[model samples]
Target: MPERPRIRLVPLAASLAVFALVLRAVHALPDTATGLSAEMTAGAKASGIKNVVTAVLLDFRGYDTLLEIAVLMLATIAVLSLRTDPDALSRRISGVAGPVLGALTRAYVPIMIVVAGHLVWIGSSGPGGAFQGGAVLGAAGILLALSGFARPRWSSGAPMRWVLAVGLLTFIAVALLPLALGGTLLQYPDESRKSLVLLVEILLTLSIGASLTSLFLASASDTSEGERR
Candidate 1:
């Protein structure tokens, strides 16, 4: 007969202790909830950004957004490092795309590109942003890959690397440029606040899109290469 697995008491006790602490912390909170909607709304208005969420993300907490973008870039690098293929970006899926899939990919990819642009453009005033737009763009790339579309040869080269780095570089430059001007970090001049935010969003969208696409292609290529071996 197979032996039953034993529960490790030490680790289980540690987990229970941590859970109890979390429960105590949760229980200590007041029944009533406080919100900062008014404060965020005022901040948004002062910042001249119609979208409160955008104002909070890009102006009030710009450094956090910057770090998030850097993390995404790092993740893409990690994925690429694990890939065995040197030209992962140019690799197509293993099988030929069916007629329906090929036709749909041809039609939808352009629409997805347009939608991504629209998302980024409307992010300043609506419930969309660089991340959302970049996700759509990445999806378009994945669809193309699944449809057996081979990336252009140049996409596997330095230009693609530059595209992946541009977002983080632009963000870092913007963040430090204010310091050079004797202002605090990420503090855009009053006149160019909106413009700066828009610029950052655009560049971030491109970088995020490229990074996500690279991650997918690299992982898929790695899996395919392993199977063939």
Candidate 2:
């Protein structure tokens, strides 16, 4: 008899079956069960945040936010390690972008910064929050990089690193302080919840902005060298 091909399809089939079963189970969950949703809604109101999703992401499930930031940081570091020169692509792109884009970038950077700051400040009671603000700030950085106003070498790596860490460190500090005071981590019953949430949001905004900007520049630099050749 002829030998069968070595490739296995049984495991793949089994995994697909398992995934389908899990999806079905998830779909069967009660849509009307208001337990988790209600709690989040109440937390949003109590924290004075208008956006329920932001409240859930930054305050109700703050530990998850920290982990998410860590994941982004780790992914960035991994990309940097694997790349020859990250900024190469962006730099080359900038070279061909022409003066119009450069002029627009120069004109818009300050406005973007102001808008990002406003979003962070109003996050406790608005649709905008840290992630939104961070994205806007990252856009500004991209503009700066593309316009040739700031190079990766000219930017301060140390200060940027500190900005990236500030949110995680602040969260840790707050959570640990509560634990040190004989309470559970992140249990902020004594202090004003709104205030605490706002502070965290602000730090997260800055940290995420800095981290994203660094990642963009790093990637651009890595890719730029290749394009130049």
Candidate 3:
């Protein structure tokens, strides 16, 4: 029989200590377990946003959300940088689209656009927001790319780059604007809070959609059949 490996006392002790700390933290939880719901609800009301999630995300925790979008921008840039094919953005999925896919895409893309717009607009008072709307918009773009139904001529140009950047740029601009007026960063002036948030959401939808589509185009280069003429 093989000799059994000896368990290290030091590691065992460390593991026990970590487990003890976790248990202690768990035990410290309040019996009622009310959580921060009350505070968050108050904050949402103070912010004048009917959607608590949106208020928390775009208002109370703006910096974190800002960093999230910035991360997405960075990720898109990284994906584009790593692409081996120079003409990836100009390429589309190869092979002809079947009539069914072509027809569905033609009918669905417009509806998706309208749905995305509704999501963005209703976010302030409902369940949807920029991220949700952007995701849908991005999905529509992906559907178009996959079906090879339509590829915009402007997709590979500087305008597309601008679309990819407008979200973060506008977020940063809005965050800094408060500083010039003697307030903290991202402190929206009461009068224009809703307006600023709406603007940011709209730009974010565009940028997020463009970024996701660009990432797909860049990353799919190797797998695609051939560049379209």
Candidate 4:
């Protein structure tokens, strides 16, 4: 039987009430944040990033962003833990990809790769960055899957693991590097700020791409396993 509307409304109302309370608390603050743009703009210049928003995310509040990356990694780990067998897609691996869709994927994948790189490159100065570029790369991965690309018994081999971990490792290392130089955590020295930010963005973009693609592959694996059962 379908759920009664009133039963659904009970939980819905409770959630709404909680959300309203949180909003009220926020409203009570005399603007929880003020002069945020000015601060971010100044910091952006100092961080050697042309985009203030990007600087804020990857440099100014980098510790927070680092925690967010950790959360993403944890989520990926949780998803991987849910899979019982990684080899379930072995037979499906041999299927040939062809026809118009395959050709289209071939064409698009390279373009997406280039576009993603462009986004990352321009991100320091414009309205793009690791997340946007990573999303493009993730889309390319999906397109590849649609083109009948198959997974190995373990698609997530050492290379895959490295791609997944590189961004995080680099970020932490960069953050701690300042400590070695007597700078605070995640602080980029003025001399190398631009190069460092670019390097981190490139690594992070690749990591995000791999992480998202891994999640997609895992979901597909789960679906395949279910059908077999």
Candidate 5:
């Protein structure tokens, strides 16, 4: 007979201890010296972006944004590799509530597109930025996919890939430009800081929006297939 796996309490205890230590370290920080508050105050005047949080995410800590974009790209690629054919699933769904859902999705798609555009455009100056805006756009894509309007196919693959890559590539290129000019990587000491921040934000918004849309569509397709089976 095959042996059953045994639960080891030591590893679990160790994990809990480590987690507690990390939490304690985090809790010990002074309120005024918090990363967010410090970043906000430092970036508020120079970022040109009216929203402090957005400025921090895209400008002050842009390396974090780059890594986030990379993570999103990896996730998108993973999901796409595992995604089911949307057409097959749509055919199955269409037989039942297709028309009703289709109408609703079509009606809302325009509004979603507009909102996403607005979010991306105004992100530098407001609460929304590339990540949030891209999410909104991705949500719109999901709505379309669910409603059976936009079927996933290999033809749309190129644009999707470009969208996924653009943000990260842009960020890398821009970051390197500063380094080439004798500034540190991702540091905009030469050019106006606001200009550099805006450039990064634009790329991030595009990259984030595309990555999210692709991931959502791929996951939705997978879930729909599993349900059918």
Candidate 6:
């Protein structure tokens, strides 16, 4: 075995060096009060949502959220791209589920859709939003897939692309809409801001849900196809 070279840290010298740098950095701090609370409050009020968290997510930092949705869509695309044909994972269930389970799943799905939409609507006045609602909707999508309810919308490339990128496209369109109307990007008229915010959230909820469900189903189906191969 070869002997490795010993590193020379010289503990006392390193400690002094670190301490000096920390002190210098601390001394460089500026004396200014943060306005985070004020900013968040104003943003929420402007957006007309009682849920400050939702306002922040879908309004204050909407661009980031939009990008996040795009990223998710991209990931789903990457996964789906692995296969050449749409039937890559057309198989929904590994085996036939009993009628009881099928009936139960059917009953459960509508309720899930209502709950998911409710969450999106209530987001303006509560701690919920498209992301939360979308999560629920995505769960419903998984259930549908398991029960052999999904019909691979991906069979048609154009519509499938729209489904995956809807959220991002909607956000961008909304932001640019204001510009077309002589307002800044994402800037809504005072009278319609609340309505507009709600509309965006609803759109986002659907898009996110669809995108997430696509990702899950693609992975599941792709894996099944691979196993079969």
**Could you say which candidate leads in TM-score?**
4
Candidate 6 global TM-score: 0.75
90: Cα error in model 5, Å = 4.9
lDDT digits (tens) for residues 122-197 of candidate 6? 8888877889999998888777766766655553358756765667777788778889889887676778777877
The 0-to-1 C-alpha lDDT of every candidate, in the order given, reads 0.84, 0.75, 0.86, 0.81, 0.71, 0.76
Order candidates by TM-score, high to low.
4, 1, 3, 2, 5, 6
Question: In lDDT terms, how accurate is model 5?
Answer: 0.71
- For model 6, the local distance difference test gives 0.76
- Model 5, 1-229: lDDT tens digits are 9999997999989999999999999999876664467657666766566778777676678788778777878887777777556454455445333667867887888998788778777876766777777777778766666565666552147877887788788888877777888878878663477776666666776677667666655554434545787
Estimate, for each residue in 1-229, the C-alpha lDDT of model 3 and write its tens digit. Answer: 9999999999999999999999999999887787778898987777778898898888889999999999999999998788787465445445457899999999999999999999999999999999999999999988887787655444556888899999999999999999999999999998888889889999999999998887777776544446542
lDDT of 2 by residue, 88-168 (tens): 654565544467976788689999999999998877666789899999988887777767677654333567667778887
Clashes of each: 0, 20, 0, 0, 2, 0
At residue 160, give the lDDT of candidate 3: 87
- Name the candidate, 1 or 3, with the larger TM-score value: 1
Which model is ahead, 3 or 5, in terms of lDDT? 3
Q: After best superposition, candidate 5 residue 162: deviation in angstroms?
A: 1.3
| Model 5 CA deviation exceeding 4 Å by range | 1-23, 26-39, 83-99, 154-156, 189-192, 220-229
Instruction: Look at candidate 1 and tell me the lDDT of residue 143.
Output: 83
List TM-scores for all candidates, in order: 0.86, 0.78, 0.81, 0.87, 0.75, 0.75
Candidate 1, residues 1-229: lDDT per residue as tens digits?
9999999999999999999999999999999777778999998887788889988898889999999998998888887787666565444445478999989988999999999999999998899989999999888877876677745343356888899999999999999999999999999988899989999999888888888877777765444555897
Q: In model 2, how many backbone clashes occur?
A: 20
> lDDT: which candidate is best?
3
Clashing pairs in 1: none
